[model samples]
Target: MKNNFYDQNIHYQFPETFWWGSAASGPQTEGAALIDGRKQSIWDYWYSVEPERFHNRVGPEHTSDFYHRFKEDIKLMKETGHNSFRTSIQWSRLIPDGFGEVNEKAVAFYNSVIDEMLANDIEPFVNLYHFDMPMCMQEKGGWESREVVDGFVNYAETCFRLFGGRVKYWFTFNEPIVPVEAGYLYNLHYPNVTDFKRAATVTHHTIVAHARAVEAFKKLNLAGKIGIILNLTPSYPRSQESGDVAAAHISNLFFNRSFLDPVTKGEYPSDLVELLKERNLLPAVEAGDMEVIRNNPVDLLGVNYYQPRRVKARKEPEPENAPFMPEHLFDPYIMPGRKINPHRGWEICEEVIYDIMVDLRDHYGNIPFFISENGMGVEGEEKFRNEEVVIEDDYRIEFVKEHLKWVHKGIQEGANCLGYHIWTFMDNWSWTNSYKNRYGLVEVDLKNGLKRTIKKSGRWYKQLAVNNGF
Candidate 1:
């Protein structure tokens, strides 16, 4: 394999249609929570309700302040060679109550941002939700209740009708599994509740909501594409042993195919459904829900690949017949001598990106795809500051380059991927972890009132974008 790091000629130039961009969410980067008639999201409520849970007790107010500084930030986007950008429209900002009259200020703010991106030759790919539910909606049962699904569909339709023409690519939700696991099952997000039943229900409802949004988009006959963003964690076995392979298969079925099957293949993985049914934990579904999911398939898929899971057969007995855990059938085991990202404790298996794309091509058909989010999070990146206080983050550059190689491999092997957008464009607020995990190409100086500085990786990305290869 030719190393693209230095061998520029051997590195394949990206397609002319490639989208060079970065991604941020409304809640993560857009501060000024209460400004311009914006209401409170679950993050806002979480900060108020449990301040201690956040890193350094720094609440949502301490984000990059993109709400007020978008005009300036758009300049930064242009400078970074971002011909396209992805951002979410905050539901609370638009419909303060989660489902009612739209806030004019919020609408105007988003319009300004979208128009600015277009004016600057940047395509705006708008995502509907990014894990920030309105406080009002969370109190009313969040995704666990059917009402939230209707509310989300309404919110999605509103955005589509409002900005469908300008924004060519519309994503229904960003990593819908994260909210289901973090909020309802694992207690990492707002309205944190550790109930498997609720988690299962939320997962089911989120898929339904995504389908409903797709259905709505089809009805609108918009001249754009709509899809859902999934964090695809490819599962690998510890060995070729049947038990290990089975464990890995079940793990893939639980995480990857759980959503992929329905969205792409238009049906849930039978093994996963059977496992849940055997434990009597299958989410209650109305007769028409399955039809909605099966009928409205995605036009594209945004894959966020960060890590892979290595699994082994479960040795321990089930916990007193408790609700079914994927671990009950498969245990996550670290592969020996695998590369690890010591900064974030995530195993670094770059080949997983290629494998995932291949799997999608083989199982789910060759749907248009994008590497919507892929980046490393380093802790205390400020320590790299030199005499000039500039961040020289070479590790992040290497991280992106290695991943891009596999992306190139996937493209060469017939994966219908369209583009790649790093996990973030700049450092901003991350839920629970807050700003501690810096995954941005640009370093944000929180102490200096959220100042931005393009890191070494950002400069490298700019060149890559300009040259269409490293």
Candidate 2:
């Protein structure tokens, strides 16, 4: 059945050099635990202790098995019109102890993957860390300790010396803020501590580590660009009321500016610093740190836009003398009427991508950027499976097209936007959610030992790449 929904006139053409690909992480996709000298990460430890917390009791071991299947998976990348592909290096796999002695098997495996990607005409964008710190490092305070920062520098330097010639695009970290919030404050990740102070400390150390890694990459003179992938959530006030606007600004400062200012501008926002200081929650910083951060600016920025945050002034005050929370300064309010992703429960607000790019250009001097991750995760995807191995995922197709349109708008408006890479290439295990949320263009059949089946969206995306648009 030919389904032609997007009018050709409405589709905007992309540049010839635009990156058409998908992104995945080592922890989320690779599932060869205890194989080829790979060591356990924080995730491996967490799932072992509490398998019940994961959906379907599936742990890190049941991912897409990319560790053993990269050769086959790279073939799928070529089939799916991926001229470029992004994947992360597992920290534990590279440096099992988080510092010394590179695992020769891990190095050989990554070299094979990179070589395969190059052979298939797929540009490999490799990220250094993706929320998979080795268990040894976590036991010794993880990102909170300065020693971990030094270890990270060593690990990054090792990668540059080993694979720098082949891998051209290097990313320092992917969404560093998530760990601070989820692990340290919200109790969602490993070493789950509900201490705001630790969260602040971890966040600071991560930035410092990023700066150190960038410094190491430059010192080693690696022949590539080094950048960080940030999940940018543009915040909007619920109404035009002054209080509502103020609330939105604070939310933006905490979530966006907190990282952006330090990475791009070399300092944290004064207002955010003041707010934290007033609440006695400022991060500890040493002299010369600001200089290092300022001097080592990123070459590019990866924007991962999923949804916009609609915020308003808190309707009620926190319990008298309660601990500080983001909500203490602002409240997230649901807009009365907006398009929503029923499959994933995320608001389908495409315009936010454009707004975010504009904000970046207006505030951050228009550094070259790309949509690093964007995709829709649907539940119960098997229902749409056809006999020919096709899954009618029109919703996913629509999600990509809508977001690309706004991304095109940003490019046209001088946003220095480079390209768009979807969140995933195939259905792999998600953290906590496991495989419940399917964001892949290719569906993985878990019951059948992770059989790969390309979905309807994959075919649609291929044509989009072939034509540069719909």
Candidate number of the best lDDT: 2
The segments of candidate 1 whose C-alpha lies over 4 angstroms from its true place after superposition are: 1-10
Residue range 1-470, candidate 2, lDDT tens digits: 44343336636888889999999999899889778888899889999999898888889975899988999999998888899999999989988988788899998999999999999999999898898989999878898888988899889888888999988899999998899888987889888888877888998899988988888888977678989999988889989999999999999987888888888888889999898998899989999788889888898888888998889988897555876778787888988888888877899899899999998899899988899999999999999888886898998998998889888988888998878899899998898899998999888998898899889998888887777776
Clashing pairs in 2: none
- Candidate 1, position 243, lDDT: 89
Every model's TM-score: 0.96, 0.97
**For residue 466, what is the lDDT in candidate 2?**
70
Each candidate's root-mean-square deviation in Å?
Answer: 2.8, 2.6
Clash tally for model 2: 0
* TM-score of predicted structure 1: 0.96
RMSD of 2: 2.6
Stretch of 10 with least lDDT, candidate 2 = 1-10
